[model samples]
Each structure stands twice: as C-alpha cells, then as structure tokens.
Target: MQNNKSAARQYVCKRRSDKMKITVRVKPNAKKDHIEAEREGEYIAQIKAAPAEGKANNALIKLLAAHFDIARSRIKIISGFSSRNKIIEIIYTRKQ
Candidate 1:
C-alpha cells in the first residue's frame, strides 16, 4: 500500500513552514459571538462588536489566537480591513 500517512505528514510540515492564510467572513453586531471553521482555510466569525473603532478587528484577532493557540501578535489582518470579508495571516512555527 502507498504510504499516504507519511505524505500527509509532510504536507503539514510544509504548511507550518509557510504563512497560513485564513479567509474570514465576519458578521458584526451579532446577538452572540462565535467563531466557526466552515472549511479548511475558511472561517465564519460572528462578532458582538458593532464593527466600529476597530473593535471587530480586535475581536477577530483574539478569537483566531485562541483557536490556533498562538499569540495575538502572530495573527494579522493582511487585507479587507474595512470590509466584511477579511484575510487573516497566521504564522505557524512547528516545534520539532
């Protein structure tokens, strides 16, 4: 049989070396706040913040940091700063 597990492991290792991009779809002013991973590299974030004064953005970074178990400083909003659809960057450095 083909060693697919090893190949998959290698793929994950490569991903850790590269900057991971997460495409987020935000719904601000939601009744409740939550984060969902719709699919790989895609997320849906329902924020209670009113999308004002960068509060929503801050919430997003905080949520992502907790989900990825990384520091807030490592996650950045690379684009779509003022839009519902935003691109978030996460730096993953695998501890080998």
Candidate 2:
C-alpha cells in the first residue's frame, strides 16, 4: 500500500506539469456562466457579464479557475484580451 501511494504521487507529478496553455472561445452576456471543453487544450466559456471594461474577461478567469480547481491567480490571459478568442495560461503547484 505504501508503494502504491508513492507510485500514484509520481504518476500525478508526471501527468500534471507546472504550466499549461488552453485556447478558449468566450461568449459574453450569456444567461449563465459555464465552461465547456471542446477538445484537449480547447474550451468554450459562456459568461453572464458583458464584454466591457474587462467584465467578461474577469468572469472567464473566475469560471476557469473553478473548473480547473485552481486559484484564480494561477490563470493568466496570455493573448486575445479584447477578442472572443483567448489564450490562457495556467500555472499550478502539485501538493504532495
């Protein structure tokens, strides 16, 4: 049992790298906020806020943080800040 736990930790460390990037197509002013995974490293986000004053972008980050089960500070919008298509980078540290 001890060996199995060690192996599982190693497997998780290998699978979850320190950082990853994902592309998202955001639909602002939606009825509700939700995220959909279209494919590997791709997603669709529906936000309840309008695309103004960075409201939609903030909502997207919040939604993604919850979906990925990471802190909001770990997610960054790397590109397409003012457009529907966005590239986000997530950085996280695995707990032992």
User: Pick by lDDT: which candidate is best?
Assistant: 2
- Tens-digit lDDT track of model 1 for 30-78: 9877888665566778998889999999988988898889999988898
lDDT of each: 0.77, 0.81
TM-score per candidate, in order? 0.79, 0.82
lDDT of 2 by residue, 6-83 (tens): 221111111257888887889999999988866566677899999999999999999999998999999999889999
Q: How far in Å is the alpha carbon of 3 misplaced in model 1?
A: 27
Candidate 2 residue-pair clash tally: 0
